[model samples]
Target: MSDSVPMTPECYARLQEELKNRIKVDRPKVVQDIAEARSHGDLSENAEYDAAKDRQAHIEGRIAELNDKLARAEVIDPKSINTDKIVFGATVTLFDTDSDNEVVYQIVGEDEADIKQGKISVTSPVGKALIGHTLDDEVRINVPSGTRIYEVTEIEYK
Candidate 1:
């Protein structure tokens, strides 16, 4: 067993879909490629065979990793969350006092975090600072560049 992975139901479903595709589609294609490459000529000089073998290894490794993550998944539904304070699956709007700009970020699991998409991992510095804070709370976070100050303006579960 491994440490439990906290993720939204959507993220869990996406992982399951990826696992299914790898096992049912990618695995067979790679196997066929390997067989075709083997029929070409000498193993030592066959670049296609080596490439196919490498692809097969990568696919297998990903399959195992996805299986482990799915097995240890702890799915959290955003719609069911009810809290005044910030927590997992919370879409938070922060007002940056220094830049005088507002930014929205959704606190999500590591696998689902995408800064460009306004999703931040719960373990991130900003996310850690925002946790347990209610609306209008001032949060100061330290990043790689420097320190930043933000005021919580809005909090939404969905």
Candidate 2:
């Protein structure tokens, strides 16, 4: 019944830092801007006031969203887990059976997924295929190009 989602320690810290900035810096700046705009005059016709209000709304909405995610986050430390099998937060190295190339990818939460950084979402097809698999396990996944096979070469918690 919990809506908690898995998050890395780094990811949690990043979220906390962003929330702190929004609350401590961005929020107060917007308030000051609104105050300055209000002083300029008419409530309905003030474009600066309206713009400030909209910015405040966006900042507040983002703050709330970040707070909610932080509250529901289940921080999973990679170092805390000791397993040869691939799981969430595990860095996996695989050898492409078809391309004869090797690739490394870290299984991360959806929010931290960046393919260019070698981080893949747990919900992704490759992540799903790699999960629960161990070294030497042959994995076959169907891609748009066709079926591709990979041989798990390594799994690291760090």
lDDT score for candidate 1 against the true structure = 0.96
Misplaced by over 4 Å in model 1 are none
Superposed model 2: Cα runs more than 4 Å off: none
**Model 1 lDDT tens row, 35-132:** 99999989999999999999999999999999999999999998899999999999999999999999999999998999999999999998899999
For candidate 2, write residues 48-111 as lDDT tens digits: 9999999999999999999989999999999999988899999989999988999999999888
Clashes of each: 0, 0
In candidate 1 the C-alpha lDDT for residue 124 amounts to 92
Query: What count of clashes does model 1 give?
Result: 0
| All candidates: TM-score | 0.96, 0.89
Q: How high is the lDDT of residue 90 in model 2?
A: 97
Clashing pairs in 2: none
